[model samples]
Target: MTDAVLHPDSVRARKADVPVVLGADGAPVDWVKVFLGFGGMVVGQFMAMLDIQIVASSLTQIQSGIGATADEISWVQTIYLLAEVVVMPLTAYLTKMWGTRNFYVVAVIGFIITSVAVGLSSSVAMMIVFRALQGLFAGAMIPPVFATAMTVFPPERRITANVIVGLIVTLSSTIGPTLGGHLTDLLSWRWLFFINIPVGLLVIFLVGRYANFDKGDPSLSKGVDWWGLGLMTAFLLSMQFVLEEGNDEGWFDDGMILWLTVTAVLTGIAFIWRQLVYWQPIVSLAPFRDRNFSLGIVMTFVTGLSLFGGTFLMPIFLGQVRGFSSAEVGNTMLVSGLTMFLSAPIAGRIVRMMDLRISMILGFALAAWAIQLGARVTDEWGFWEFFTLQVARGLGTMVAMIAAQQMSVASLPVTMMKDASGLINLIRNVGGAIGLALLTTILSHQTAVHYMDIATAASTANAASTGLMDGLTQVMGARGAADPEGMAAKAMSAMIRREASVLSFGDAFAALALGCWVAMALAFFTRPVKVDTGRPQGGGH
Candidate 1:
């Protein structure tokens, strides 16, 4: 190829040396290697996701084991997220330099090594350091898996592959907490990290045997965009620190938080400038120009919000509001996992047969309804009460995720697949972070406001309040408890707090439902994508 066509940043170009495989029907066939390659990739991806979920459930146990305070232990998760998001957008460039197979092999091996180090860690600081390293490699493994699915098969088979990817993604998150709780309860918390060893080894061997993607493009590395790298890293790291710390540190009220916020904004601007102007930008921003890709990314953000936000809120509601154990909280999510397992293949078929717009609209609509229903939750809710909600979440999640993936990259050229994959996945992760932050803030602020409102109303000499107090006093008297008046007041106060907490949860779910509706509206803007009949390679899919 000529220099102009050979430019790695030439979004219109594809290397001539790459091979394309087609089936007897004159469509690109799903390579047998894809099954082995993507399957193994899924395993590694599962480990990464499982690690996050496992730690979330076992946070208290881990904190006690490492002799860390509650505040300090939060960094174990914060640092991992920081590292993961920072590396996700850099995958395409890194793969070009190291070659896809070589890069993936190294990442898998590094992940295994770090998992062991994390398991053996003796101090909070040591665990954080190792976890950050693990997150780096783990994050690197994810984009490639998605990119592989997009390229491995024709548009016809791509939906199936995407569904499989969605299945593992949803399943890992659903099962993580329950499994982690069991491991920590029956064995040591260190076993959570140890569990990755055998799986990681298996993944490494499978990837080595079956990976057939691009080896590498040496020319792409000739002009490294160091300026772009610096600005991007600055933006991601500063923003992560701010997001994770802003709520606890009082947001912009703290001087350090304020300064970092400004720094993140400036770096963010500079990074955008570099990507638009620099010839060989580390991240390709070209995908956003396509209408379908851009709109689909919006839907992806909503999907992330629901997935991560629901996961974050459920445990807090169950564990704190209902006074359930970690194991019980995890058990409540099993319904979601089971539903996803059964629903994803059906979703894949729906995407294959129905119009893309209809598929996405249906998916987002179900998700919105599910989240809205979750708003009806009360303090008295048990596992059965959440059944329909979990079922809706699972079905909605599978449908939305599969349709969103297809819609996002459907119109992009093959050469842009790698960058587009990385960008789409990055947006999803950022969405999750933003969603979790918003939900947590809502819960805190709303709980305090509701408590104050109830307290104020209680202070007024209302007849209903008087009746409640009298009833409580009578119950205490009937039980022959000491200090009936004091016990009645305490009981009333606890009741007020519980009601306030449930109200806060309801508010959070309502907000999530509104977000889903907005995503569904955006789905209409995506340009229609037509599957090519010719035996084309990655681009047309």
Candidate 2:
């Protein structure tokens, strides 16, 4: 054959009528199949994220259904998170072994089956088992979607893909409680898992048919790092257990917590060492060599802290302090979800137009300011009072998340995208775990401190305290209560507890605001990436 006939460009030129877009690797890009497959993965991602907090508002119902005590019921959520975290770092290795299409489809099918099993569970043990399996399967769905966004799309279209993924990440988690509350009220808590069936089948169909982004390397499975994988699992499971149960079980004072903490520290160190030295590491550490990736990982960790911390605190405040029902709390929380949805498109534009570091700084600063506003909350603060704060939070989260996601992987080689994506996600989850633990500890300790201070101040010596007690006693006596003074004292104690809880929430908000400020400062250290504004040079199909 002649040189012209043999040339790749000439070969493509001969089929001009068939129009093709070349990816970074010089392969023809099927935009339709990419999007269709990607859309399915995104939906799967949404389902997984949504499941994280979907049971939040309906925990009591689930507990009742399964005959679980309040103490045992929390394991339903905790187990899933623990299992999910353990599987995340291993995603890159698994993806290489099975290919993206096979790995993702198997995960979804497993998730769906476990979902059905979870819904049919009749006891707490059965529920936890199925939930853990469900989480394992669902964990496989997240990191690959992120890796796909970076690898499958060309540079110019990456921001758009990142924006969509960011939206799904934030929006689904934000609205989970609200959606769960409605579903539980209308149908039943069992419907939460059942709802995933139809949607998941659709995902399987789309992904199985169209997700052909990469080929599997069966050779990579030959020299598996069993030691590294074992150490990693032990470390993650122990660490997650320590974080999840530490506060509830009295931190270091509890024997199990103390032992687990030691195990976590020891195993974590060993796991890192194993990964660094192993010939075929289950999880690669090479991605950390990139400065931008390291910095982006830090920013993502803080984002998760703020995202999950804020989500956790608001519902507690609404439920405990304001006495809002699950539905009302969900309704109030919907403000942040709506704001995130509305600001997503705007965030995409800003990410494209602004320098990434500047965009990150702006985003983190806005979130910090908004959270500081929340620090001034009162017992009477409700939906309208939190409106502006939620709006700022929503906007800030979208912008920073998209920028962080881009910065974390954009500079890495295509070969490292999978590892980097998985690492980024893993760090974010660890941040969230740490944030929740710290916030819960602070809330509990601060509440006790505040309660004592307030109680001491409201003594018999204080005229206002005496007058209030007398007034309450007179009102109870007028209502024909036999023990007016005793009832008034109890009422005063309850009031003090309520005030203390509110104050503790404010303290938590301030802590989160401080984290945002720290993240904003760190943004300055990230190097700027050169933007690729040039459109893909190819004929339109």
Candidate 3:
């Protein structure tokens, strides 16, 4: 019942050559309890990651439910992301203060309370407030799982642990919209938040009972860096705001975006300076000193860019260009989710067999190739066309993710695992945010440019244009339209817009492919890390 009984001291070698993990009391601990505790935390993490995209599919329903305007409704997601980014890096500090079990359970409790509040909300303001709280709590649940995967399992079992973690992280995000759509259709948007209740309660029980990997250091509170915390919160929140809203608000042309960009830069610089100079920084920058960790963070960022960017783009294409409903879009996107699930075990095998860098490069190359295939996208493309693309993407994401996850933490001492985990996860989320912003900007600019070029070429002087116009006019006349010629012109203009949109999508896909290729090149720079087969020294409970 005590921490000593739940989480053993560390791994010890026996005369029989079997490695047994000992508890705080130096007694052998049950691996089953450790696995179950870690599993509970993983489930909690899945719930946190799932909320990021679940509401995306049913934003309209939620908007109406909360009586929000279209513009105001977007804040439902934006506020959550902003709050989450602010809290993610600070999780390491909190975990060290409260220990893994207490921090995780408290987070789940906070998440559950806010979920219920969000579901019961009657106004946009109330919903946003609760959503921000939910995100803050949910953010605390993510990093510890990554750290635990590396620390709790020995090197022999690390690959399998990484695979499960990688699969859950990617699969949950990939399937979020699909599940959200079905839930909304079967019930309502409120169910999205309501559904977290039972699952959260279960996580609480499991984690409370079995998560005893570490004990709280109450002494850490004395040196808490309040200044650094303030700087980081301001920096991350401002930066996230700029990334989330810059595209819609016309980037630097908008005053708010411009000011926020400046604020973000200044505070970000200050935060870095404070972290370097301050004795006890809120979030440690020590993880960057590890060559593998630094390189792994970069790869992790690219993985997030491709994963989130691809997820964002496909639904837009399906819904806008293909005229698919939310449920239909979800169904179509399931290809990528299923592929990710299937490829996880294979990814584990590949990571185990091949050099980590080689595995990472292969994954990035496959992702680039898949996105490059999407560059040939046409308005007529459907499920089958995207099916091939999704398969490659799913495989590439899983493999790259497992490699990146391992490389990020493998080189760090156990003492730094929590800090490293927080930083890596934060970078990935930031990468996703930046990717969405860049892709959205590209889609907008290219659409207008392509539309103008196409419109200019489709003039009356062109025989093809004239002939098509005439045919459309005749068809409209036969259909008894009053303004047949004018309607034909309008129809031609709409067609041009649709074509322009498709072309822009191709350009965006090309951009994502370029990102993947760049990441592939960067993978070569990472230093190789030794497989960790024994207990990490000096950091165990």
Candidate 4:
């Protein structure tokens, strides 16, 4: 169904009167055209995100194939994320000039090229370059998809439209991790990229054939606030670089770290100012003037942190702590992906029938609570425990994520929604960056603090320590001598690691809990826009 905004005149018109596409008499939109156009979008988006996680599940296999160090291998994820975030703000401008129809098609083409290139890459450098390119276009494509939907959709069904979009997006989300993981296990890692070729080609054909909407003026997109985009990019890229390298470089003492910190701060400030004052601003800040929109933006930002942060952490836990293979970690997410896929439509239906705010509050609360449950997990935790957590996340995210997205956007003018939605995505990108950095740093710090305490305990130095000495004595006796001191030290080493694990997981849990509160607060403060029920008009700002 096209988005049906309720307006004064439209209140009297049946749902069929709403125009979703162009007509001489302003006839109702063709829902079939919209669904087909949108379906292509979902396919492309799903393909992109799927490639990312699929590669994740097969990292070990790729490492062996390409012969790169762990440091270099990190580029696979980092470069892709960087590329995607870098181009996000530009998407609004691009679509404005080019029309979403043209913009999305081109973006998909770029992504497809990179996907194919990645499959053909013979070296690490080539892979990184192509991956970055793919990310750039993929980044540009998402906002316009929604914008087109909003622009063409009728107002009354705005929330419902978002729910449908969300359901499709969720499907993409799950498909990436699930299919990618399964493919990685069944085939080699390179197949992950190779797999995109056929699907991408099909999308290209469909988009060309069906999404033939007229291209608007190109100048709108081309006159991007490059200054703004540049600064924002540098700030994000630098900050991410620092976070990724801080541990290895020994934190602030490193000269590179100091320079990056300075650059990032400067660029971030410039970016904010550009948004506030620049004429023909690359990004529009107008949507943020509304309290509901602003609050919703905050929720979206915080939720991004939780979403991406959890996406990063879960695989690490499965692979590093539990000794599961990369394939296993990916497969685990796949299971949760299935649950998410199933729950999305259900979530959409509920939102259509119920107050979205209630569903969102509950959803965010539940997701936060579930992540907290993960804190208590030991290395001994079975697959079932984590599976349960994923199911909870699947359901909660369905509620909070969709509710937040719809409420925040429903009030914006259709023309301006591309920019608004793009900006929201950008915020989420930054939030994900901050979340990942902060979570990793906190985990490391807490683990170190715990490790040091246990390692330096007086009991270890003293032979009289009860359990410590007893365990030591037995090991020594087995070695044919009572070397109590050495045995005590070894025992401390073993026990301290477990303590560190507990502390690290606890920190992650705490972070997720805080994120939930932020999302809830955003939802609470949002004021719903009053729709005119008598006639259909742009409910847009």
- What TM-score do all the candidates reach, one by one? 0.90, 0.92, 0.94, 0.87
Candidate 2, residues 111-147: lDDT per residue as tens digits? 9999999999999999999999999998889999888
Worst 10 residues of 2 by lDDT: 1-10
Worst 10 residues of 1 by lDDT: 1-10
* Tens-place lDDT digits, model 1, residues 459-498: 7999999999999999999999888989999999999999
Q: Per lDDT, what order, best first?
A: 3, 2, 1, 4
Off by over 4 Å in 4: 1-28, 168-178, 181-187, 219-224, 325-335, 456-465, 479-488, 530-541
Candidate 2, superposed: residue stretches over 4 Å from native: 1-20, 23-27, 533-541
Cα lDDT, model 1, residue 223: 90
- TM for candidate 2 is 0.92
Tell me which of candidates 2 and 4 scores higher on TM-score: 2
Against the reference, the lDDT scores of all candidates come to 0.83, 0.87, 0.88, 0.71
The best candidate in terms of lDDT: 3
- Each candidate's root-mean-square deviation in Å? 5.1, 4.8, 3.5, 4.1
**Model 4, global lDDT:** 0.71
Q: Model 3: which residue pairs collide?
A: 8-22, 8-23, 9-22, 9-23
**lDDT for position 332 in model 2:** 89
For TM-score, candidate 2 versus 3, the one ahead is 3
Better of 3 and 4 by lDDT: 3
